[model samples]
Target: MKKGGTAGTGATGRRGLLKRAAFGGVVAATGALAAPQVSRAQTVTWRFQSTWPARDIFHEYAADYVKRVNEMGGGRLRLELLPAGAVVPAFQLIDAVHAGTLDGGHGVSAYWFGRNKAFSLFGTAPPWFRDANNYLGWFHYGGGEALYNELITDILKLNVVGFQNGPMPTQPLGWFKNPIERVEQLRGLKFRTVGLATDLFNELGAAVVALPGGEIVPALERGVIDGAEFNNPSSDRALGFPDVAKVYMLQSFHQHTETFEILFNKPKFEALPAELKAILKYASESNSADMSWKLQDRYPKDLLEMTQRQGVRALTTPRPILEAQLQAWDRVVARLEGDTSSPAAGPFFKKVCDSQRDWCRRTGVFFLRNEAPSVLAFNHFFARG
Candidate 1:
């Protein structure tokens, strides 16, 4: 009876051992699964560069975007912001991002006009009959976003994803040794501009030089460029434009509805989990709204400072010159629309232009009919006695 009991106990012990080993195997399997989850929890950092120098207000705008992304990224993603020329020259930012040398960047689409003239259509040229904000309605509600994607993914074949924000007002004609009052003064003049505005000025017979923002003031001082325009009053003041030239040409058709572009390397951008991607997109949009509001405050204040303290002569571009600019645009459009033998706008440009015109033509009727005339209102409230 005792021997039989010992054999029974041995069998029970074997069963117990087997159960323990099986439990250990399940524990090991769970730990293996958990390892990947832990790996995913690690933070990802992106190297982002801006095409504006650190001192420029545009760079502050870039920083505003970075700050929003960092705060909203939920510790899983971080952006390390660098100013222009940190990773590559401002003009070469798209190329650097495309090659994966830089993870992302902030710049204007017009900066890449060397690659395709159609790029200018995204932001910088062919001023539609509305303000920059009104035109951005076309970019978002109309087919502009899709065409912009096609330009990047299909036509230009750049490995990038971009969003355009920061609707700038009508750019100034520029600063010259003397005020540019007549269309005739543009003849044989040396001027600086970018994007299709270069062509616009060229048709007016000015020798147009394309320089980045940081270089514009220096070029003007060195006579490398005779007269130049670099965005707005704040940026121009920061670039030391008032020190070099006193005449600040207030408004023009050139770059009348420009915006800033924020770019990401497509593969890198896609690899981000959907949450982080959403953060980036929403961050761009939020920054855009803030920029439009902030500029209203900053631009007016800076213009005041320049005019009141800095001996700057802020003059409206003459009516005749404005009319001439419109006529020049008509000719420029004809050439780009029909010119297939060269790298002018051609078919793809037509697609973009036609889309813009379609949106503008439909919306412009309502705008022209109902839009308030601000000049009369301003004169009533604020004009000097």
Candidate 2:
């Protein structure tokens, strides 16, 4: 009986050991199955710098972009945001991104007109489109994107790729110490602007000083410039333009519409997984739409505040000055199209210009015929006596 009990006990111990081993094997298999997923979860991090001060709405836009990308990436990708001067000066963003000193950058293409005249076509050129929507349509669908890539990658050979965002509204004519009632007043009035508008202003006989927004107020206070236009009312107000000089011309053709450039190093961007690349590109478009909406909502209130609270004298720019700007743009475009000094100047610029002109011709007609007269509407609803 004792021998039989020992045999049964030994058999039971062996059965328990087998069960334990089988359970261990199952756990091991499960871990093996999950290993690839764990490895795939490794995160990719990128550093992005913006050509905007910490307080500017441009920086806020940049942050929003990073936020969307991060949430969409779901821990697989992360982007770090830095303000202007974080990596380099605001204007050096293109070069820094190209050099891989920055993983990415946000700025306006017009800031780099010194590199290639064609860049102005992507930025704040003269009044070619009726509004930001029309301009962005031309950019996305009207062959502007291809030409932009050719200029950045093929023509200039910069090791970067870019997208357009921040569909800006028509910029103000800017702040002046004295009211500009005639086109003649622009002559020799040390002015501040950027992009092709600089050339246009210079053509109109203004000694144009191409300074960034941060420097404009100081320049104005020191009497270094007689007039300046940075962007919208809020940004200009934030920069203290109202304190220094108060004759705010409420309209202009110099930069009727503009967009921001979002740049990434070519090699770095290519190294990203396909999904991540799409996220970066598509997020820019999303941000562009969001920015336009925000501007429309916020700018009107700010303009009113500047007038009602800050006691700013906002006046409509004279029609003669607008006509003069159009003439100056014609001359500037003619000179750019005719010059062959730079390889990318003549044909490439003309190609972009021709595309925009065709789009403008078609779309402008529709806008004029189909849209209600906005000036009359404004006069009816909001015009002050």
Off by over 4 Å in 2: 1-41, 377-385
Cα-based lDDT at residue 141, candidate 1: 87
Model 2: ten consecutive residues of lowest lDDT: 35-44
TM-score of 2: 0.90
Clashes of 2: 0
Give the alpha-carbon lDDT of every model.
Answer: 0.90, 0.87
Candidate 1 residues 134-206, lDDT tens each? 6678889897899899999988788999998988988998898898988989998889999999989999999
- Flag clash pairs in model 2: none
Candidate 1 lDDT for residue 191:
93
Candidate 2 residue-wise lDDT, 112-201, digit = tens:
998887898896766878887788899888888898888887888999989988888888899998899998898999999999998899
Error of 2 at 376 (Å): 3.9
Clashes of each: 0, 0
Error at 310, model 2, angstroms: 1.9
